[model samples]
Target: MSTGFKCRNCGSNEIEEDNARGDRVCMNCGSVLEDSLIVSEVQFEEMGHGASAIGQFVSAESSGGATNYGYGKFQVGSGTESREVTIKKAKKDITLLCQQLQLTQHYADTALNFFKMALHRHLTRGRKSTHIYAACVYMTCRTEGTSHLLIDISDVQQICSYELGRTYLKLSHALCINIPSVDAFDYLICLLASQYLLERI
Candidate 1:
């Protein structure tokens, strides 16, 4: 004899028995339908078969089936060490490039953060690390109101300006970063200042 019980919350018939909690829960809405009900017998039902089976429920955890977790071919260390190494290397590269470009420390840190985001998005795959670093710096400068031009970064990195521009565009589009337009007056001011300093020294 079976008694029909409907969930008061969702009125769902898909109820599951929680033996540990001694409660009947609605699987649909996760509401407790019946509580503190004493169960006389627990029957284990085999999956893919309609009839109930009189056997103990074997846990995959106890059977050693779910013991080991792996990352297939991508496991480098135990956990997260490989990812940390990649980040460290990227930071070092960015720092060096920033020093070469005479960027301030704030801009360097900002560029490092952007490079980390690009790495997380897998945008650095199949591309040279130098190009990614250069692009990050370029984008950071543009977004932070700095006057560093793409040609200036390309000249310092000894890479083609076209390649740096392409990578910058790709990074901007992939990351959805809205970089502000470069002010022509900023460039003119920088050039004039540099010429004056050169003439003085």
Candidate 2:
């Protein structure tokens, strides 16, 4: 049985097996070729009960194992909480801005969607969230054929008018969003409203 197998170390076939210890030894280099061979079967027999049983066991070698979930339970829970907090805050700010500007529900919803998109694109980086939010509202008004100048939005949001304009331009170019030209009537109406409010003050 040992003659067919070659010693891996010395390439010798002079192998000897010790049945008691279950080890096959290479006689040429005194190296162990194989050890702890399972050569016997375990039998269970009942003498007077007239019952005999035989069992065979098998095991498989595994290359590796994997887990289903990558993140821990606490990590996933905390991440969900953080996301919810951010969304809730954004919604509150957007709603307040819309109310202050007296925007209709339709326009408010459109602006909210635009703000969410800008958040998703990370366009608000290194700038106040309020600025991005105001820009979205301004863009939404323009898109909906309503006139709201950058200065008007900046006044409402308390952001610098020039900074808000630059932010809006950056967002429009980066997102490839094309807003329609403001209608002449929209500007006229806004101007008249501002003059009317000024006269009242």
Candidate 3:
């Protein structure tokens, strides 16, 4: 996440966060930089497509799935879960994943938007949320020119890389999002830099 906050004691950039303790500490000097980090619970599920009439009304002729309720219970990824529950789980998963991948907030938000689009278009039906969320994050990394590879997401999600790639391509085509070709050099640079950091540590 490349936070700009540095330790006052040792002026180190290597700060570790313990979410359980809500503490940001310097790895070099073992000094606490911030004792309180506000973890936000305001999630994407709260924003219910306000004022978008299109979000409310869908033609029964076009809608082939089971009927849903205003309370937000719907079919998603093979599970009949409420909108709040599904989106909340996705929100938490994406947040933790973005942090693990060191993706910026822009990329994270873009990924979440893509997931929302998928939900709108019913692309998530009969699919696994884990794969869908992985695909969203991978698509964000691809479209935003990030150096993260699809295999990275697969490793974290414990899914097959090819399956994840297929999900990503399906979501891209369904959302009509144009993903750019990856630059091998950027990935190489990222890998080398990661190796350097490991050696430094």
Identify the candidate with maximal TM-score: 1
Q: TM per model?
A: 0.52, 0.51, 0.51
lDDT string, candidate 1, 1-201, tens digits: 113677786576766664433456554433446766554576655668454433233234653111223368633223324555676788888888999888877777778767766765688999998989999998888887776788889899998776666677778778777678656843454355455546756
Cα deviation at 78, candidate 1, in Å, is 3.0
The list of candidate 1 runs beyond 4 A from truth reads 1-80, 183-201
The parts of candidate 2 lying over 4 Å away from their true place are 1-76, 182-201
lDDT tens string, model 2, 1-201?
355778897687867664433457665443566766554666666868565433223224422211122356422111223433554577678778888888876666666656655655677779888878887788787767665666777788887665666667677667666677545744454455455546756
lDDT of model number 1? 0.67
Clashes within 3 Å, all models in order: 0, 0, 0
lDDT of 3 by residue, 103-165 (tens): 877776667767766775689998898889988898788877877887788788888765666
* lDDT (0 to 1) per candidate: 0.67, 0.62, 0.65
Candidate 1, residue 62: the lDDT equals 56
Candidate 3 weakest lDDT stretch, 10 residues = 50-59
Residue 125, model 1: lDDT of 94
RMSD in angstroms, candidate 2? 28.3
